[model samples]
Target: MSAVGPAEALILLVIWVVPAVVLFFLIYWAVRLAIRHEGRRVPSLHERVTAEREAQRREWAEREARRNTEAPDEL
Candidate 1:
C-alpha cells in the first residue's frame, strides 16, 4: 500500500530484469549455435532452397527431353 523506497525498487528491478535479460541472451546464443551447426553440415536456408529448386529444374528438363525424344507409342 505504501510507496516503495529506492533500494527496494532497485532490488525488485534486479530480481525481475536480470533473469529476463539472461533468458534473452540464452535464447539468442542457442539459436545462433544451432544455425552455425546446421550451416556446418549444409548450406544456409536460402542457399539450400535455391540449390534444391535448381536441382528440381534440371531434373524436370531432363525428363522432358527424354519424353520428347521417345516415340508416340511410348506415351
Candidate 2:
C-alpha cells in the first residue's frame, strides 16, 4: 500500500478528532447535569410549601362557593 499524503492525513485526523471532541463534550454535560440534581429530594422545601398554599386556596374557594349557593334561613 502507498503511504498517505498530507491532504489525506489531515482528512483522517479530522474524522477521528471531531467525534472525539464531540463525545468528550457530551460526557462532560452529562456529568454536570447529574451533579446539579445530586443529593436533592423531590418537592423540595419551597415547592412543598407552595403546593400546600395552593391547596389551601382551592379549599377556601370551594367553601365560599358552597356558602353562596346555600339558601339563607330567615326568621
Candidate 3:
C-alpha cells in the first residue's frame, strides 16, 4: 500500500481540520447565542410596523420642512 505523501497528507489535513474547526465554532456560536437570547422578547409584527411607520412619517415631515424652507417663495 502506498503511504500518504506530504501533499496528500496536507490535503487530508485540510479536508478534515477546516470543517471540524468550522463546525466547532458554528456549534459554539449557536449555543452562545441561544443562551444569550434565551429570554429576550421580540417585538411583535404590529409593533415593528408601527415603529417603522412613525419613523417614515417623521422622515417625510422633516424632508418636507426642509424643502419648504429651501425653496424661494413664489410672488
Instruction: Tell me, by lDDT, which candidate is best.
Output: 3
- Decide which is better by lDDT, 1 or 3: 3
* Residue-wise C-alpha lDDT for candidate 2, range 1-75, written one tens digit per residue: 999999999998899988899999999999988988784647779989999999999999999888878955567
Encode model 1's per-residue lDDT on 1-75: one tens digit a residue.
999999999999899998899999999999999998887885679989999999999999999888878844453
TM-score, candidate 1, is 0.58
**Candidate 3 ranges with C-alpha deviation above 4 Å:** 39-75
Give every collision pair in model 1: none
**Model 1 regions lying over 4 Å from their true place:** 42-65, 68-70
Clashing residue pairs in candidate 3, if any? none
Q: What's the lDDT for all of these models?
A: 0.91, 0.89, 0.93
The backbone clash count of each candidate, in order, is 0, 0, 0
Order of quality (TM-score) = 1, 2, 3
**Model 3 residue 39 CA deviation in Å:** 4.6
lDDT of 3 by residue, 1-75 (tens): 999999999999899998899999999999989988865869789989999999999999999999989995799
**How much is the lDDT of residue 41 in candidate 1?**
86
